[model samples]
Target: MAKKTKPIRPPADPLPPVIAPRVSAPPDPMSIDPEIQKMADDLSAKVHSPARDLELVDEFLDLYRRVFQQGNPIGLNEDITAVLTGRNARNGILFPPASPLIVKGQLVDRWGTPYWFHPNSSYQMEIRSAGPDKNLFTQDDVVKNPGPDNMGIGVGISQP
Candidate 1:
């Protein structure tokens, strides 16, 4: 006896191609004043120097202390502030500016998970991550120290 074959089903109505949203590129970091750019370059170059690193870190900490003392307020974004202050420092020939400097920090909790923070805002202002080497919310992993053998902390300071 021959077996009957099942009839083929017709294709569903063709769906329109799904298009992804376009992402705008981030603003250029070089658009800042040439003087400020020079200062940033100078600082970046000295970030590895032993004495200079200590001085920069101390300057960063001092600025944060003052900002905290003034009470936490909104509109304290660091990127723009850094550029403004960096310009002043460059013109004044100051290694670091007198304004509050924002620097990135990373600490591993007891569970071995890293917690990111910006030292300029507030000590309690932590940038949380998902868990276990997973930087779910952050744009990238916490920057590691670039010193020889990673002896010092990998820190970045904002100009403001």
Candidate 2:
């Protein structure tokens, strides 16, 4: 008797490949054009200086205390001490020239970049960004367009 022949098996199908989600790169402050980067670096250097840092902290604290006493909206540059300590204090404070508070008001940065300010505590007093220009006109200068670069400060006083 003749031996029976065996049948050949079929090949299996290949599995589908997995795909990953695409992620966009974050904007780099250092890569914002050579000129802008240089300006930013300079401003950063100034801010990091030990003497400047101390002075800024002192000024911020003073502003905080002033706002706490006045119980009114204060601008970024207004002499907070005078407002809080003097009876001539206005009910509402104006934004100082190129003040961070101005950016907070306009909802944009020195380069027209937008940002948000969410104070973690009521006692918190100020918000600011020393952009490339290091000027306060962004908050106070009446110019419709205060160039593309300027520094700013924001002062706030919350209810007790």
Candidate 3:
């Protein structure tokens, strides 16, 4: 009979030594710029609604009109917007000589959905979008048009 021998140990990983992951330091909020912070706040406001309310729909509709139709007779829509936004100022004269318009925020409904602009006439356009239900071409959709005494109508809107 032969004597029993102890089992041999397996070799360890033949690579770099294992090291613990380095923890990152916390960021300093004070390092942020006021203007950038304000822009962030404005963007956040645009993506969300107050009390989840869509009261800004009317304001958005009015802005679309002024941006799309209120341009000078000979001014292109792009030129008008660029001028309004202080871009391509050389074309600014193409826009109305009156005080230039500056639209704020994004072209979105109160629900953060982009408003659809369907041009049906030279001076009139149909700006619409899905309302709170988030369904397009439905009764719960908002619609606004050109002309005096303009009013927006949709299912999500509560008429007083």
Clashes of each: 4, 13, 0
Residue-level error in angstroms, candidate 1, position 49 = 12
Q: Pick the candidate with the highest lDDT.
A: 3
The digit string of per-residue lDDT tens for model 1 on 57-81 reads 3343344445345322223334323
lDDT value, candidate 3, whole model: 0.42
Estimate every model's Cα lDDT from 0 to 1: 0.37, 0.35, 0.42
Taking the tens digit of each residue's C-alpha lDDT, what string does model 3 give over 25-107? 76542243454334334434556543222234333324434545552322333333344332432222222222112223224
Per-model TM-score, in order, reads 0.24, 0.24, 0.33
Q: Residue 148 CA error for candidate 3 (Å)?
A: 18
lDDT of 2 by residue, 51-123 (tens): 3332343343445356556332244333432332232333322222233323333433344433222232344
Instruction: Assess the local accuracy of residue 65 in candidate 1 as a C-alpha lDDT between 0 and 100.
Output: 40
Please report how far candidate 2 places residue 79 from its true position, in Å.
Answer: 19
Q: Which stretches of candidate 2 lie over 4 Å from their true place?
A: 1-65, 70-89, 92-94, 97-104, 125-160
